[model samples]
Target: MTIASCGSVSALTLGLPNSSAVPAEKATLPKGLFVARIPVSAKTKQRLANDIETITMLSLLRPSNTRLAVGTRIPEVLAIGLRLHAKNAAIPTDIVELIAMQRKSGIVFVCVRDADFEGTKRQECAFAVRRALPGRAGHTPTFKVFVSDWKPAGEAMLDIGDPAVDSIDALWESLCSQVMLGSASPTALDARMTRRMQAAQLAEQIDKLTRDHQRAKNPEQRNEIFTKLHKAKNQLEELRKLEA
Candidate 1:
């Protein structure tokens, strides 16, 4: 498995043969495994519309039905394929809202497909992991969401024909790493979220400052805006470095 970093999101490339041969409707898991075709309720679709332009299909992958009893810690896993209108579609910014709409407890992997002006199909895949944090007496539980970048699609197909337990275990293990299920500490994950938010805020601030600097006629005002923009950019770069 090779991971390529694209800004904040990382693309996972599982070097497997015949991955592209399988159709989207086919289960990626080995034959005889429990792959259920679950319905995407109208209400769910409407909620997802906030972030996604269109949803093509949603399927549930249950490890409990397998003979090997994999994914003991995870209750459910979702595979979703979406069609977006945006040419360069990345993971949705408000992914937490999309997670909140889910009734099950587990990770979500999305395959986004869109076409350029030439009508050539382009696909990208990403994963979203959510962890529930303990809340105060009166407050509801808060969730920590970790999203990967939309990478070129291949591993997202998950089309594994091997039924061997070792193969399945290795596959699940790779997925577990993506969500940082047991590998990452809560404090570490929280710090990541903080940095992500800070970076977004700083980027927005820099954009506004740049516009203000451009509009300002007075040399002193322009100089002040430039100073602020430079500071914001420096802070954002530090945050990106930390993420890397």
Candidate 2:
């Protein structure tokens, strides 16, 4: 079963039906299709997972690996092991359905990590898998399930290993932009919008200077480069806002 929410670049994985035996139905199991303007809800989440399972299973007839995520936050693990199906194969129709089913099987994992896994190796990943599989598997694969340098292009299929990643707002004056757009609300979009502006501007400066010694032509060009450097510096001076 192939499940997808196309609008956002999501790195979520839901463990359900093994993609190997699931059947495909084109009308229901569309891959990466958009569901624009639909408000998020419990029911909607369940439905999406179901659809994706169908699609995932549909693809399984071709001999793909049974992979899924186990969202965790041990700081030692990335996503965990499980099979991700596109069709509504192994997935329950609702949160209740899933939880209820867990008593018979196990908890359903939902991955919510970003594109990068922060930098964990295969051995570390194996440890993570062992941690999750306390007593489930009777026959573990010979090869430890881990990637050396996996950088996902799409949220595609992934294991939502263990809970959310521990993110902290390590506010440093350094990352903040030097220029304040205004005394705007601390949570306004206008203020927060400058964050990326600041980051990009800073990135360009770093790149320019690193290559400046190699490719930068002259001092005048360098000064122009520096001017942009500061603008980039103040790109995120404003604050963030939430209207809702």
Candidate 3:
């Protein structure tokens, strides 16, 4: 999943709000800024392993009384952050499980980070949206999850030395734009992932066929390999076009 760039604004420039201004040692968020400081249990921490040092819920956004044109309320949005043990630590992949544990719905803004170094920090921030899948008769319902690319945070603000209120507000606006535009909808991201996987598999198959064609002593075997190679190349080309 990757962030769909908007006009002249780069994705990284509009990444999640830097939590550097929020002290790491304290779980408390800015006064009157957040809704609550949801606790992270020891068992949950164990499940995440040492990859994440802490998980903090900064705020929650709910729909207002006003209804939309669709006559439905906007989904709830959760702003959360995870402090990682190191820069290379894996970002959490089990978003569904995480959301289920929290008993929350709708969109999630995730910010995963490592401690600062040389006045710079390593972070991965993205928005994850969940969609319910249509269930078959007598079958259980499932869900499709879409995640925007984990964009680097605070690069443009590095020289600023500290997180400013305006910068933080801008970050929130960028995040809101993503949700409002539906840029990271499940169908679009899922299709892109499927195309990428197909392209990769085709490339690997073509490479193997090329090697097999060279090693084949029989003319018939070589011709068969060549045919398969041609077909794979065409398929790959089609996928590339879809990507573009």
Candidate 4:
């Protein structure tokens, strides 16, 4: 846990507003639980994405979110969220690297709100977000954040415990005492997210090919995609086993 003074990482993730080179001073004691909630009176409502970010910043301030529940739709918040939640915990190096890699890879989940959320299903997605409880994933113990938001994409529910994501909360708690913003405009998306979107699109292509092979009337095409899918499934299984 102390290999690389994680206190610096802590400072960066929690919006200290200092440069990376600047060292952080010891934090003062906590005051009280300050949740931001917006009451609708003169204003109709704020933009979803902006509101999500504002609330996210508030949740990360204290760094102890065990009792806090954050909700957002922004994907950029994942890196910040992960870092914030990871500060006090002892995460293994492999998981830490994987997190850093995921942050670098920028792969994101897009919630599919269709009535038939195929990606959100247990078997389809390979993991059950709601059932994972809190603060970990698998025997590997992926670092967890307290504000767990379930994003239903297809049949797979991308368990977005990260506060950085905008698609996390369906409804922002009005009295939450924070600004609101969810799933910002594409302009607001970071480079990491853009890359993630590209990767997702590629995954979709592969998925279609596999499904087409399954549904193909022609035996040749069906065999082609089926073979590919079999290889893919096996590869994913191997990766999971490694993570496990």
Off by over 4 Å in 4: 1-206
Would you estimate the TM-scores of all the predictions?
0.45, 0.24, 0.53, 0.25
TM-score of 1: 0.45
TM-score of 2: 0.24
lDDT tens digits, residue span 83-120, model 3: 55566445454533454344434344354555455687
Measured by TM-score, the strongest candidate is 3
- Candidate 3 has what TM-score? 0.53
Ranking by lDDT: 1, 3, 2, 4
What is candidate 2's lDDT per residue for 1-244, written digit by digit as tens?
5433222221232222343323223323232232333344666565655543322111121112323222132111112122233311232223223222223222112222222234641111100111121123577523211112222323233222222211211111101111122221223323344454455566777666556645767888877766765564454232122212
Looking at model 2, which ten-residue stretch has the lowest summed lDDT? 168-177
Give the alpha carbon lDDT tens digit for every residue of 135-178 in model 1. Answer: 45688867665666555665443432333323234334344345
- Scored by lDDT, the top model is 1
Candidate 3's clash total is: 0
Across 1-244, the per-residue lDDT of candidate 4 in tens digits comes to 1111121223233232223212222222111112123232222232221111111111222112222334333222222221212111221222222223333222121111112244342211111111111233345533321122332222222222345323323212111101111332223223323344444565676687776876789888778888887776665555445323
